[model samples]
Target chain A: GAGVSQSPRYKVAKRGQDVALRCDPISGHVSLFWYQQALGQGPEFLTYFQNEAQLDKSGLPSDRFFAERPEGSVSTLKIQRTQQEDSAVYLCASKRTGRETQYFGPGTRLLVL
Target chain B: AQSVTQPDIHITVSEGASLELRCNYSYGATPYLFWYVQSPGQGLQLLLKYFSGDTLVQGIKGFEAEFKRSQSSFNLRKPSVHWSDAAEYFCAVGPKTGAGSYQLTFGKGTKLSVIP
Candidate 1:
């Protein structure tokens, strides 16, 4: 009954610093998604994975944003040389195979100073 | 490209009053629509989703939504809203890609405020 969970609920990074956000999806979930949400805005898709395969990375803003799900369970979103424009909440969601509904995690709030 | 729109940026309603939140979407085909609620510092919670068949779908917390194909709209409603219903509501559309994958596009979100 465990839902998706993210680590470092709050992260404060200086400009030009790199940060890594972690996510743990539900057990047996085959599909994972990452989204970015700005203040007073809805979440926007960033990337998607299906069992260790990165299916979609089109939503990623730039080369600085990279994600990987190596073992098909845990996922990590990395941002290199964090910038003020990159400050936002990063959310993780997971869904079972053949299911449309996705369960979301608490999200990691990243602030660039 | 698929997109969702929430016309109302904010709505205020009294407790026990009926409530309705408007949502519109634009897609090439019949898209999968969903309503999600989010509290402050929390993740999104699914309210209801409309795929096919019935135009009316019921969800948790006494929430319901009606999908109108002609209008390209999926509006959320409740007969009587509780104070706890005050939160941010989002409308999203999911479109299937050529690779057999699905991607969701969400609206700007509507903030609901309840008064006693």
Candidate 2:
């Protein structure tokens, strides 16, 4: 694709329900990343992948948050037992192996009520 | 842990006026710095970055930023502001992991409003 793409531009989930967000990175990009942005705040790192290898996931807020990139080209972020505090925008980004710039997706706004 | 700070919550500049947005960062070692702009309902667009070499780095859309190691600052500037330039600006610090992957730490962001 021309740029990173995320699915389900918006989501509404009841508290305690599970939600899964998806990301499709640009073709041939070797690095992928996930971030969470709260209302009126900058995006915060959640996890990173280098060609299917989960290199780092230190920024994930809690055990309920999980992410995977089994095939390297696509990724998913799943949140279990969603809470009101889980309301935020989930962002995905990807970049070439030798590049510093990461192309971002439109983001998925999740609202837990 | 590295962190970024965008001191100004909001800034209003008239069209054709010079503009500067302040940023500060905290890290034990030299860190990669970046500036990104975000319009409403849009993803962030990179404005500039500083990894090494000359302090002043130029970016797209007539944007530039200077990295000052002494003050731990990377300030974004433009010679003339445009109404189209109104957006939210974020400052970020990249802390390279052991494998060289950059996990970015971003500031809250400064909202820029341009007055025509």
Candidate 3:
């Protein structure tokens, strides 16, 4: 793809429902990242991956939030028992390698009602 | 640990006026810095980045930033503001890493409002 692509650009889920967001990073990109952006706020780092290895999950807010990059090119972020507070835009980014500037996707706007 | 702070939550500038957005970061060693812009309802787009070498770095859209180690700041500046330049600007610092780790710490963005 030309750039990072995220699925379900807009999602509305009832409270307590589980939702999954997907990301397809640039092909062969060595580094991928996930971020959460609340309304009127900047994106906050959630997790990072180097190839198929999940090197950093320190930014995941809680056990309810989980992410995986099984094949290294595609990633999924799962939120269990979503709450209203989970309403925010989920962003995915990719970089050619670590320590480089990231290219972001259009983001998935999740609205937990 | 690494963190970023964008003091001005909102800034309004007239078209053709010079613009500046303040950013401060905290990290132990030399940190990689970046600035990104997000237009309304769009994804984040990289403005500029500073890794090493010169303190002043030029970026797209006629934007530039200076990294000051002593002040722990990397402020984005543009000589003239355009109406199309109105957007949310973010400042980010890369987390400490060895070789294959990639993480970004971002500050609450400053919203740039252009007044024509």
Best by lDDT: 1
Residue B114's lDDT within candidate 3 is 97
Clashing pairs in 2: none
Candidate 2 ranges beyond 4 A from true positions = B96-100
Please give the distance, in angstroms, between residue B83's alpha carbon in candidate 3 and its true position after superposition: 0.2
Using DockQ, give the best candidate's number: 1
**lDDT value, residue A39 of candidate 3:** 97
Please state the error at residue B46 of candidate 2 in Å.
0.7
For each candidate, give its TM-score against the true structure: 0.98, 0.96, 0.96
lDDT of 3 by residue, B58-102 (tens): 999999999898999999999999999999999998854575355
lDDT of 3 by residue, A5-109 (tens): 999999999999999999999888888999999999889889998888889898899999999999878999999999999999999999895447799999999
Candidate 2 C-alpha lDDT tens digits along A1-113: 98889998999999999999999999999999999999999999999999999999988999999999998889999999999999999989998876677878999999999
Residue ranges of candidate 1 with Cα displaced over 4 Å: B96-100
Which is the winner by TM-score between candidate 1 and candidate 2? 1
Per-prediction DockQ, in order? 0.79, 0.70, 0.76
With a 3 Å backbone cut-off (N, CA, C), the pairs that clash in candidate 3 are none
The candidates, ranked best first by DockQ, are: 1, 3, 2
- TM-score, model 3, chain B versus true chain B: 0.95
